[model samples]
Target: MYIHSTDVNRTLQSAISNLIGMYYNSTAAKPGIDYPEIPEWPHGYVPIPLHTVIRKTDFVRLLTFVLNAYELKKKNVAGKLMFPC
Candidate 1:
């Protein structure tokens, strides 16, 4: 099965968003963790900061590459698979 780069990017974005939501919700539900409170905007309007926007894309790319490499290792346990540098 082949996956396009755009599709992978979209999936990664969704996965990151879901993970963040889960983490935040879990923290809110737990009392022992001492999670910091997130400040609320007026009328539930939250703005994306410029720094987060810049760093998130790079973070997503790094995470996706690492996951792909891990999958490759799991599939090629015989050590016969060669990846181009």
Candidate 2:
């Protein structure tokens, strides 16, 4: 899935926007947990930037999901979604 910077940025922004809007009508301006340079992270925590989080394999997986989402013959498989061949 080799996602570029723009796609990653868009995804992050959209996810953050949705999360922020979940319980409040107002939005706050702040950097998210995606920023990994911050010190004193939570215990047993290892932070990675959002752009790096979604790797090539993840992109491929997401592509499969996207394709599967539109598959007419798709069926539930152990609570998992699959694409039709």
Candidate 3:
């Protein structure tokens, strides 16, 4: 499902938390040895595609672009980043 929300911390958190609650008992939420099962991430949580505002529609669109050194070269390119620094 294409999960959407307003591009902001509050809305994003609400969407994520809701998805977690919705799929908490499902296998999709179950951690795997290579995927969400790694020690770096939380157990029982799977990565779901959470889309926000569409590009060219709002200022948040700019912030949504993935930001990294290579992405900073191509344009910062990961969800883990917030700014281009």
Q: What does the lDDT come to for candidate 1?
A: 0.49
| Model 3 per-residue lDDT tens digits across residues 1-85 | 8887877798899989998887665454545642455667766666679987655675555455533344556553546555444
Estimate the Cα RMSD of every predicted model relative to the unseen true structure.
Answer: 11.6, 12.2, 14.2
User: Candidate 2: where is the Cα deviation over 4 Å?
Assistant: 1-7, 25-52, 59-61, 65-85
Scored by TM-score, the top model is 3
| Worst ten in a row by lDDT for model 1 | 41-50
For all predicted structures, in order, the TM-scores are 0.31, 0.30, 0.50
Question: What range of 10 consecutive residues in model 3 has the weakest lDDT sum?
Answer: 61-70
Q: Give residue 51's lDDT in candidate 3 (0 to 100).
A: 84
Which pairs clash in the backbone of model 3?
Answer: 66-76, 66-77, 66-78, 67-76, 67-77, 67-78, 68-76, 71-75, 71-76, 72-76
Is 2 or 3 the stronger prediction by lDDT? 3
Model 2 TM: 0.30
Candidate 2, overall lDDT? 0.46
lDDT of 1 by residue, 35-84 (tens): 33344422322222222234445665667777898889889879899854
Model 2 lDDT tens row, 5-32: 3346666676555544552321232234
TM-score of candidate 3 versus the correct structure, residues matched by position: 0.50
Q: Choose the strongest candidate by lDDT.
A: 3
Residue 57, model 3: Cα distance from true site in angstroms? 1.9
